[model samples]
Target: MVVLATKCYVEGDARSRALDGMGSMLDDDLGELSVEWTVGVRDDDFVSVTVEGEDATVARNLLRERWGEIPTDGRLTAGETYTGTLESWDDEGFVLDAGTRVRVPTSELGLGPGSPSQIRDRFGLVQHLPLRFVAGDADEPARLADAERDRLYEWSRGAGRVNVNSATRGEVRATVNRAGHAGDIVTVERLGLLEQSIVCAEGTDPPGLLASIGGYLPAELKCVIP
Candidate 1:
């Protein structure tokens, strides 16, 4: 069983829909392998996959590589990198839901020149977005992974983007099309199962794109303005 690092926090029908969507996705990811898999959500909302078949080992590693995994043992070693979902943020820092709450201080964010909230806003970080972070040693502090920092910085340097949560990648794409701004976006990048980033086309305005599609998606949207 590989506990996926991304979460499934929606409730009721939304939750079912999310899991069903993931099931379909799993078919795409592990279909070629000779394995049968079951998907379930943990008590704390992290997703888990149980695979059984001749190719189970290969399937497990593929799943772990595709979606980061939470250690079943619940132990995080210092100096190792892990992926977590963005749970909340404050003046002090950001809290990631990685089986446990991994608190990353603003001083350790390394994204530059902003409060945690400010940095979140600038980067268009939506709630429940998956983020990669490096664990702290005894004398150090937890921080965003260098690769994560580079990714966020690259977003700001791009054409612009509108990050969103609470909607599937397909849903985001449909919303953009329904909003009559399909041409405004280059693509809807899937950040996680339910989190997406709409990469704007050159000359497209991130805020304007958000406004156009906001009404269509029952989700949170933030802009990464270049």
Candidate 2:
């Protein structure tokens, strides 16, 4: 997947416009299309859409016609880089990376991190950690180490102790014993490359609780055992 930073005139409407433009292009050029929308963390008003297709040409054309534009800083070239810029009331647009451009809405720059590429990089570092699994009800308690344990305790003091084990084939097999819950099987896997899935008797949420674990672990440390 390719990530491009771009600016636009309508900070709140840009995502919809871009998606609409892409849909139009796809309908006219390609037979059918599929698109997925994801919410942005920085602002509830902003959304990001991921489009996939069998024809690369269609996708390229859609991006070019709708969201493609050089930044005001003149730092981008058509073939060299992709830049996102936002338009101003004066009819001029501001480059996302440009410091002096005020007409450009700061939110329109879309240069902030958390792009798929950035998330992928972050996940790469996290995948090396030893997988820990816990099973049972939400009230069940789990033990953690260092900042991870501390963070979990802070979120919910009742999180049961984790059973550490190696991950294989996208499953984490470990032994866990919680105060009120029985020892049960647990599996942890990638929801995407960037997020993880926790499966147990009780419902599972993404292991955002493990963010601290990632922070404390070395890049070379293997979080998953062979």
State which candidate has the highest lDDT: 1
RMSD over all Cα atoms, model 1 = 1.0
lDDT of 1: 0.91
Clashing residue pairs in candidate 1, if any? none
Q: Model 2: residues >4 Å from true position, as ranges?
A: 1-22, 32-49, 56-66, 69-81, 87-226
Candidate 2 local lDDT, 98-180, one digit each (tens) = 21222232232232335433422322322212211111123432221243323323323322222221222122322112211
Error of 1 at 210 (Å): 0.6
> Which candidate has the highest TM-score of all?
1
lDDT, model 2, position 197:
31
C-alpha lDDT values of all predictions? 0.91, 0.29
Relative to the true structure, candidate 1 reaches a TM of: 0.97
What are the runs in model 1 whose C-alpha is more than 4 Å off? none
Q: Model 1 residue 10 lDDT?
A: 85
| Each model's Cα RMSD | 1.0, 19.2
